[model samples]
Target chain A: MAMIETFGLTKRFGSLTAVDDLTTRIDGEIFGLLGPNGSGKTTTVKMLTTLLTPTAGDAHICGYSVREHPRDVREHISYVPQDMAVDPKLTGRENVVFFGKLYGIPRPRDAAEEALARMGLLERADDLVRTYSGGMRRRLELAQALVHDPSVLFLDEPTIGLDVAGRRKIWEHIIGLKERGMTVFVTTHYMDEADHACDRVGIIDRGKVIVTETPGMLKASVCRDIVLIRSDDRFKGTFPEGVTFLGRTGNELRFEVEDGDEAVLVLSRLFAENGMDIRSVSVRKPTLDDVFLSLVGEQDEQTAFDLTRFRTMLRRR
Target chain B: MIRTLWYVERDLRRWLRGRINLLSALIMPAAWLIFVGMALPIRFTDNYLDFITPGILVLTMLGAALQGGSLLMFDKILGFLQKFLAMPSPRESILYGKILFITLRGMIQTTVILVFAIILGAQFLDPVLLAQIYLILFIFGILLSSITTTVALTLEDHDTYAAFNAMIAMPLFFTSSALMPYDQMPSWLAVLARLNPVSYAIDAIRDLQAGIFPAMTLAGLLIGAFVVLLISVIIFRRATV
Candidate 1:
């Protein structure tokens, strides 16, 4: 069964459409909702996690409709929200145990200890959360979400705002969950994280999923080899066959096509045939970020509100 | 029910271990009782402290309930409310458990104040009067905490909760029968005070402290408690947060 399925799931914030007509299904795998900042990534997570009810449609998690059986949906999922959930006044251990008990995790002590140990926070468990670093608080938030061991994990920008070491630590823990067969549904902006961590990536833009495909498949579909040419002047030979001609800059042309080795050789001679010698030639492979930007760039003009909110949040950070 | 109880136990233990919240919870009421009661000597019909004791008790209940409300807001801002919502406990049980915890917490604070009052020579009630006082305290706690719980559940912001507590605190205290006998007040004031449920609570407390167990006072307090609890539950059940 699909771990999560949404049909026309929509949410409106007054005049603004936070999420619109979003329909998609995520099976058992590390599915990344790849978007830049806003793009309704958090809002989508909120709806699927049952934190915010959809204004228009429905979402099912672990085969339970978010509307029909919210609790059942909730029982099958764990959400790590964007905010650092630890109360500064409480000890780290206290924060985890408190949420553990609430999540119906039996033997809260053992669960909390295990969580702390997993995150390397066992010795600092007695320390007040106020004293912990930002990364540590984020770790606690993660620990709180996993205490109950739900079937699906909803991580909203789980590694956001963390330093390199911290991000790697959290990623390692996520890999541990994957090894245990937990179906993970996560969202993030860092292209490398998705490329490294997710088996499939869903590029969400303007409150819609542009495409859901394996990371490799997505890259192969949108990006193959980047063709760059630096000419003194004049147009190059007829646009490279089966190649996407990206815009050019000052006597230079760029495009993407499959079979870079053959394509590069053909392009080199083609420029030679045009009686123009190229100063520089380079081939670029597709990164997840490029595929993401291309899919989102198409409708980027319409979703101005997402950009505005993302900017405001970024300014705060 | 069991899950909620465990939640309550975990929360209470965690909160108690946090000195800042616990100390403030106990000290806020103590300060009001000792400082405000000492400064205001315009007695109603009995010991001035006794006259205002019920109000202080009500104040403590309100404070504790506000704490409960803030805690709810914290859960929301932090996303722990989702954990409870995910559970299969009766949907309304969340409200019930929270209200119960607030009510119980209010009762404990009231008893501590009562003990302090006794130690300070605030005068003892007869056996029946003591029972009536306890009964009145329970009703008042439930009523006050219920309102706070509803407000807290509906609101997800701490600043708004703080502002609400401040906005309601002074008027609920100064305008009630805590400082003066309802009959001794001006006609216009009496009419308004009668409408304030806080007045009913104060009157009930004053009746208990005066060594009198007026059936009418007890009856009014009970009805008021029931109405407030009913309204609070409705508001809580409907609130999306």
Candidate 2:
């Protein structure tokens, strides 16, 4: 059974459509909503979590409609937003216990303790959250979300600004949740995170899901073998078979080929015969970044996929 | 109900931990009671402290309620409001919890101010009258906090929220019957005071201190609090995340 599902879920802020006609189903697996900073990932998560009402359409979590039965939907789900929600003045234990009480757990303290232990925060559980580092605070947020043992967990940009080690720790914990049979719905700008952790990824652009598939399938479907050639002069004429010129950047020319090995040999021979001085030649497989670039087009230097830039663009619009 | 209490408990614990906030709450009201009460020589009663103590108490309530509402604004900015909104509890529980915490803070500040008044040689009222006065303060706190909550939720940022609160607090305090008797004010000011909920609360507290039951004033404050609370809940429900 699908643990979460949305049909034509739309949310508009003034004249801007933050989420437009989002239709998808997230079964009992780790489903990732991969998008750039302003691609409406957070807006969609907000609508799913019942923090924001949709302008149109519907969503369901654990068999409860988000619009008609928000309380029930909330009961079955937990959300960890990009910002840390735990109070800085309160201790980790207090934060989890408070969340437990909010969920009406019968034994809030025990539940809090168990959650803290799960997150490996049992030792510093009595310390104020202000004393915690960024990673520990993120863990505390995850612990608070898990105190109720929710069926569906939503994490929005869970490792957005964390260090490499910090992100890895969070990813381990998220994978652990999946092992415990919790359906995880995560949104992130880190393509590598989604590629490695997500069971399936939906690439959202301009408030729409442009593609939904496993990471491998998405890479395979969108991109072919890329042949990169660096030369001093531009190649005006191309006579190589099975090689199609793609585009150029600086002094490098790129081409898509059926087979990288054959293309590389043919291109090297052709370049030598044509007296072209090749600086470098290499064949590489397409990554998620390549797929994203192809789908969303290239972003300007100032409009890169960073939260601050995204917020600035949002404010301007 | 339990979830509401949980939120109230968390807020109270946080407020108590911030000793500066507690100290400031007491210091502001005490300063007004001592400085303002003594500087103004209106002899409505034997001791000026007795006369202004109730008014200062309302002022304290106003400040506490505004601060309480600003906490909500902070939660909204910091994204904790989204966490609470996604919880299983009813949305009203969040509003009620904050209001309850604000009322408790107001009651504490009022108690501290009352103690300071006694230190300044103001006589104490009867226990029953004291209870009645606290009840009136509680109701007044609820009304003001509800208004603050609505305004805070409506405004977008802390600066705007702070400016709006500061702009309104002084007028609400000075225009009410807190510092002077309503009859002693100019006729136009008296008319405004009659319509001010703070005036009704302060008048009830003053009457209780003078051993007179303020039935009409208490009724007005209770009704006003209920109506404002209902409006606040409605606004909170419609509040965008």
Candidate 3:
């Protein structure tokens, strides 16, 4: 049976459709919902974690319906929110024990200690969380979530603000959990993290899943190489059949081709025949960013400004 | 019920760790009992200490209850409320836990003020009367904390909640029978005191101290607490993070 399944899950915030018809399944693997800001990644996680009731359709975690049997679903899953969730006043051990008791674990103390040890926080478990570093607090949140030994875990931007090392350490624990046969559902805007950590990824945009596949498969399905050409003019002439025009901004044009070297040569000849001066040209292998851009389109200028303004308003609030 | 207790336990653990908060909570009420009770020189009562002790006790509980709302505010601000709501426990547990913690904390703080008043030469009552006094304070705690916690939940931020607290805390205490009896006040103030819930508990405690049961007033306070708590639970269950 699938560990997590959603059947046309939808959530509407008044006129805004935050998550629309989100249908997917994960079975004992780290599945990532990758999207840009306002793409409904966090909203989808919220619905599956039973935090927000879906306006239409339903989701099931471990065969328990989120709409009908929310408590059963809650019992099977744990969530780590994007914001800091640890109680700064309590010690690390106390935080874990508190979550354990909330989950009605029989031996909360033993379970809390073990979970703390697994997160490498046992040595400093007695220290107040306020005294711990940012990385330690994130790890402590993981320990608290694991105290119940849930079958599925949902992490929403788990390492959002962490430094490079902190992010790497969190991924290590996440991968470790996956190896032990736990189904992990994660949502992140960091394409690199999704490419490196996710066993399978679903690229969501504007509350819809664009594609779901393994990272390698997704890369292979998209163009292999991307050629970026900076020209002196916005040339109007179309060149050849093998080159696919991805996008254009100002004097720079982006294209997708099967082979980088061959495409560069073809493009140089075409540019000379068209009388357009090429300032510079570069060829690089396609990463997930290229796949995401091709699938979701470049973020329009107005939408990008609105996203920043929205984030600023949230921070002020 | 167990889940509710766990919520209470979590709040209690955090409360106990803040030693400065614990000590500071008693300071203002103690000052009222000592300075205002002794130095006011009011002609209505020969022993002002005995007369104002109940007021001080109720005031102490009032302060605790009002500040208790901030516990939920902090949880909301710090993102713990989101985590707690996502847990397996019923949402009512969070409400009950907060109400229980605020009431319990109020009871503890009132106990200290009661002891301090007695040590400073306020008249002492029998064990039965004392138990009734605690009972009245407990009901009052539930009433005020329910209102404050609900208000806290609806407000957008801590600063707004803090402003709301400041606007109500002093007015509720001063306009009630806490500082002076209703008869000693002007006609308008007397009318407001008669209608204030804070005065209901204080008057009942005074009646109990005077060897009367005050059955009607106690029943009224009980009904008020129950109704307010019911409303709070409804609001809480419908609350979304």
Highest TM-score against the true fold, candidate: 3
TM-score of chain A of each: 0.77, 0.80, 0.79
Tell me the tens digit of each residue's lDDT in model 2 across B1-241. 8778888999988988888987888798899888998787675666777788888888899889888888777777888888888888887888899888889988998898888888888776467877887889999999999999889977768899989988988888888998778668999999988888778888888888777899988888889899999998888776744
Q: What is the TM-score of chain B alone in each candidate?
A: 0.86, 0.94, 0.96
Residue pairs with clashing backbones, model 2: none
* Residue A179, model 1: Cα distance from true site in angstroms: 1.9
True contacts kept of each: 0.38, 0.76, 0.67
Clashing pairs in 3: none
- Alpha carbon deviation, residue B10, candidate 2 (Å): 1.1
| Model 2 misplacement above 4 A | A225-283, A299-317
Two-chain DockQ for each candidate model: 0.31, 0.48, 0.46
lDDT of 1 at A157: 82
> lDDT of candidate 3?
0.87
Model 3: per-residue lDDT, tens digit, A111-175? 99999999999999999999998989999999999999999999999888999999999999999
Q: What local lDDT does model 2 show for residue A149? A: 96
| TM-score, candidate number 2 | 0.88
- Taken over the whole model, the C-alpha lDDT of each candidate is 0.76, 0.86, 0.87
Ranking the candidates on TM-score from highest down gives 3, 2, 1
* Ordering by lDDT: 3, 2, 1
Candidate 1 total steric clashes: 0
